[model samples]
Target chain A: MAVVTSRRGRRTAAPYAFLAPAVLLFSLFILLPVGYTAYLSLRKVQVKGLGLGRGARSEVFAGLENYQRAIADSQLWSGALRVLLYGLLLLPIMLGLALLFALLLDRPRVGLRRFSRISIFMPYAVPAVIASMLWGFLYLPAMSPLNYVLDKLGLPEPNLLSPGSVLFSIVNIAVWGGVGFNMIILYTSLRAISPEIYESARIDGCSELQIALRIKIPLLIPAIVMTTVFSLIVTVQVFSEPLTVRSLTTSVTSTWTPLMKVYRDAFAADDLYSAAATSILLAAITLVLSFGFLRFVQRRAFGEDR
Target chain B: MTSTPARRPRPAFLPTAILLIGAVYCLLPVAWVVAASTKAGSTLFTSFTFAPSGSFFDNMGDLSDYGGGIYWRWMINTALYAGLGAALSAGLSGLSGYTLAKYRFTGRSVIFNVLLAGVLVPGIVLAIPQYLMLAKVGLTNTYWSVLLPSIVSPYGIYLARIYAAAAVPDTVVEAARVDGASEFRIFRTVALPMMVPGMITVFLVQFVAIWNNFLLPFIMLADDKKFPVTLGLYTLLNRGATEPALYSLVITGALLSMIPLVAVFLALQRYWRVDLLSGAVKA
Candidate 1:
């Protein structure tokens, strides 16, 4: 009894010991960086005069100056607005198609379901950089089969990577890469639903369409919302696709998105203060959107928000 | 069997057709890459876009010969980063998650919540700060910069905690303790084997995530030699714009990068059956 109790006492320390590595890493990487960014955001390089010599430009505290510039910056506003519009386009269609394909895949006896499912999910395997590169070449007029077909048919060829249409073009790449994973998540949930529910509903004279609308779609709400929140997060952090395609076309400016502006400020313009401020603000926005959506979802009586 | 004419035989044709359309849309770009990769540099634009050619081997040769096989180095670098990073991330997540799951500790929920909050912070927001922090330590532009930052995945931990709770039973730990085995030994010998499926799932998710990720590596490393395949190919693509010859190499490099990831996807997909990631939340 004495030995057992002593061993039990010793085991109590084990949990904290097990958690040490993760805690250390999280602190070193996530926590410390976030804190450093907050610190950096509060400081600026004070130029003494011409900013030529080592002593000329000194690092000094500049409370909220960086934040003020970030807020007032037109590029940041346009980038945020563009991302908002991009998210609007991406979330609906991507989730909609994902939901539709998932529901269709769930239908019994749907032909080529396996083939369709794998093909759709295949893009999820392709990295965003490579996916955009592949699609980038396809968007080129000389290589685009769309243009080739349009040329043969004498229809107007659309410039997909143009400044005006580039948002949708980027959205297309996102949707292509995103829809499959979301579809699989939904489809998995759909598969978990017992067929007895469908059987009982079918006995009540519900058609297949009605059954999907009333049963599958309604039942998959939690899954849909989960995927949407995820997509929203990813869409906001949209970097790889736009950055890759920027090389293919001049339409995308260096500051095409808020994140891009942050990158440009930090690296190109040598303004780490502004970049840090923008980064924190962006993180705050993301946290708000995430938590806000969760709250909204909870308010709407979501079963799993807590 | 109760059959009804009222229920028009669920037309398999329409569903199949709609699905086929989506599949085509998804595969068209990949198909274009495959065809485009076969063309020699001069004939790349001259020939029809979809027309098949015989220069795939030639382009592969060029890619291998370029920069003293730096393309191959990127491939090795990618495997190192993703493989080592994911393995460590999964291990740490597993240990932490299992601790959070099976143990009653002070600030357990607080720690879990704090870690979960990390998932919501977008990669862009974190990338610059991480870059700056690493630069301070003079670790920037080094492999450790990318690998170290990626080793901590909040999502992996969340999934691990869920898996440990769902799969690794408390009774097993107790049983192991009664046998006079150490706590660490029990975790290694008893709880971990049961959590194998979950660990693999976590590892695969992190692997793909790190592999597919561009911004972190792009910001961290300026040296092309240290670049992952994605960044290397991006720079190659950038150069392709001014120099058309590099385009063929870019096309071939893009195709080569897809193979390993797609192979891993095909091989490990069966393990995703449990989906402990999202399964945690569903009631």
Candidate 2:
């Protein structure tokens, strides 16, 4: 009985032991940071007696002051609006190109399928920083081939880094970096679909475009939703691309996006309290958007998930 | 002219053209860099963009000779961070995934759900608190500050769990259990081998992620010696804003930094499965 009890106990405890490392790491990194952020967001340093000596400034509970300030901060609102505009421009075009390329590659008798797939997916290997840098140079009018060609043709050279169009330039870099990965995911999901479905659709005298539009896309709704949510989550936290491109241009401000604002607050302005509050808000927005979007799509796609 | 009547001619032209266009669009910048990296700083702006110059070796020499060979240090640091971080992360994911997939225990669902939720939390949100916490502990500038946080990947665990469930059969584990083998022993000797393909996928994903990651190291390490290639290159680019001469070195560094990752991706192209990423199995 002792041996049997010990054996069963060991078996039960084995899983926890196996999972201990991940649980510990996750707690220390993800849970701890989030909890710390929450704690910091609610606390403010009260400067006592000119704030010159130790203990002169002490952390005190601010009772939603930081949150209120963050909400009222026009810079944060502008940053959020900028990210929204970025997503608005980035999503449809990126996903559209991804879907188009995916469908084209999935088509029967497609030429250079391997080359196209590998070439398109190659950018996934390049870091966003590098991708932006490369595109940054290409957008520089002095060295840009686009401007060079335009100038040679006696046409006006449009400034890509101008404040009015820098957003579009940033959008182009993201599309270049992103379309490939999204295309791969969508394409992989497409390949999971059995060929017999397509065969029947073909036998019914439907053209390839009809099959693609009517059958392939409808079945791809789940995968599309997944990619869209992933992209949305990523877009909400747009940091490195604009940050990197900011080196070459003046349009992308120090607070061009919400996360950038958080970064500036935390690092540049040394306002950890406000940065913590803004980041918490950003995290909340991300969770709400992703979950809300997922639930919304799930309901529509599966007819109320019954 | 000799095509069979029963087979309808597929208009492969448009699809081919469209895919080729994508390929060209994707490859264009890379091609430009390959050409641009060859030009000298004096002529980089003066010359046509695509025109290659003979200063390629000179530019590479300058990149190497810049800042007492610090560029190579960044390269080595990137390799170490990515290689070690990914390996550790893959191992943890494998173990946790196997445990979650093979066994049901107390708080299992809750644990899995919490970790899955970690996937949606933006890095910047966590990055700030992580920095603060590490700062409190005097570890903010250490290598551990970056490597420690990178090892716990919720998406990796999710993928590993799916892979473990699909790949490892209950009977094999049961058979090993019937032989009086310990759980860890069986995992090490039997289950781990079966999970190799999935683990490789996890490793490559984590590898690319840590390699390409800038924000964590950017926030963590202030030491130039500890900077990864991404941060190092960014600093170089920032300096290039003032000294245009450094642009050649920055361009060369960017090109050089990409080679390892592109090589790794291509070599492991077969195992780099997106099907597993989205929880789909090819039919």
Candidate 3:
């Protein structure tokens, strides 16, 4: 593969040249949007003199007024708290099920392992909007086969779309869509662990459950943390599911999630400045939460050995 | 090899039963979509949810005729966005990742970290600002608006860097440099073939991502002509709420959308290094 044998002729401009496309794209798309969002967060439009003619509303720096409004916004807080609950509901069961499935698949005698793994992971391919739409139809009483079966069996129908239960409805879709990816991550990591470790546990008279409890789960901490952090990031940005499901049912508000609020404020309500502030604030909270999780894991993982 | 006979006899039924239950739960909606799409508009809700009718072809015909076959146009638009976007993203990620991995340059770590931080920023939050910025340049409502933002994939770059470090050995690069091959030639020729598998991995990852992207295209495009399938189906589903007749079409469209993606997922099952999810991309 190596034809050239002389290193002296290498140019200093090479690496930068290679990186120019990424640098340009990163600056234009990623960095610029962030900076623009931050810049918009601090400014508001001033309307004066009946606000009718040219220059009636002038854009001007508000110096954190939008931020103050965002901080006090009740809808934003409810949305945050709602997501907090949703995240709590989602992360544990999703990860726990994922861990369970991964462990089950790793076991020696698990049947239909390949089929179950593929079927479980298949939803990862279904986009969130599509997944929600599919589930939305199923949640509709008239359209739902589950409801049909229940009625045939003389069972009571529960409203999954009620205001009280709608959040859990959303969480179910998330778990359904998310479990497979997490399962695969856990399964992959589990596969990479040396079988010799399991052999030793077996030789020490450890049962399968005992070995799993004492060895596999403990060794899976790093992978589990990774999945948790990723889940945290994805859940906070939840948009498509609720947004799509809202159309089928009137129960979902425009500000269902914080991202939904950002969308509603920006487009629906025509309040770009407030939306900017809200998004920036949401972004900050997300950063803090993710970084805090990382730090918590790091402290426990590293500090204990000392 | 047995040191002890302490482990209980393997009970296959319990594990198999649990997994099958999970599988059924996972596949239920999918089965419904397939079953629902087969019913005629009149018979859709009137029939069993899983019962098949002879209207599958008829529903496809209606979806095709609706908006003068705009559904197919959405499918085409989706292909363009996901395919072209992922291709460009893979190219940029490959080049940038290769540079970051192989070269010792000033400010490299800083630049890489800055890009890495891009992954943490909720991309959906940036959609509005991106929309406004593109509006300034009169670029929103265009294909470039959706395609452009997607090309800068921080995660792809991170994955690509890992792939490059593993696939392209430094010794080969040094030998090529010593042989007086131009750096671009070494990269384009010697190193690129080695990076193809990695590039394809990035391509597949970015492909699914861009395929699933709803917010970017939702905010960017105002024209139905430019809508991806996700947004297209969204618009259809919104209309379907009032027009129950359109439910069959929406259901049909939803089923169709999964076909391409599921095919890809199944065919490339082996290539998906979920280790990317585990933050162990250093391979």
Candidate with best DockQ: 2
Classified by CAPRI criteria, candidate 3 counts as medium
Residue pairs in clash, model 3 = A4-B179, A5-B178, A5-B179, A6-B178, A6-B179, A7-B178
Q: Name the runs in model 3 displaced over 4 angstroms.
A: A1-10, A292-306, B1-11, B279-283
Q: Candidate 1 DockQ category?
A: medium
Where is model 1 more than 4 Å wrong at Cα? A1-7, A293-306, B1-11, B280-283
Instruction: Give DockQ for candidates 1 onward, in order.
Output: 0.54, 0.60, 0.53
Q: Rank the candidates by DockQ, best first.
A: 2, 1, 3
Write candidate 2's Cα lDDT for A1-306 as tens digits: 122223466678788899999999999999999999999999999999899988999999998999999999999999899889999999999999999999998888777788999999999999999999999999999999999999999999999999999989999999999999999999998998998999988889999999999999999988888889999999999999999999998888999998888889999999999999999999999999898654553354323224
TM-score of each: 0.94, 0.95, 0.94
Worst window of 10 by summed lDDT in candidate 2 chain B: B1-10
Measured on C-alpha atoms, candidate 2 has an lDDT of: 0.89
Models ranked on TM-score? 2, 1, 3
Q: Considering only chain B, report the TM-score of model 1.
A: 0.93
Q: A176, model 2: CA deviation in Å?
A: 0.8
Per-model fnat list: 0.65, 0.79, 0.70
For model 3 chain A, give the 10-residue run with minimal summed lDDT.
A1-10
- Per-residue lDDT of model 2, residues B1-283, tens digit only: 2342356465478898999999999999999999999999999999899999999999999999888999999999999899999999999999998988888677776787788788888898799888888989999888898899999999899788888888899899889988999989989998999998899899998998898778999999999998999999999999889999988898999999999999988888877667886557431
Clashing pairs in 1: none
Q: Write the residue-wise lDDT of candidate 3 on B1-283 in tens digits.
A: 1222346445478888999898998999999899898899898776778898888999999999999999999999988999899999999898888888888766676777787777788886679888998999999999999998999999899788877877799999889877878899998898888888778878888998999888999888889989999999899889888898888889999999899878877787677566544544445
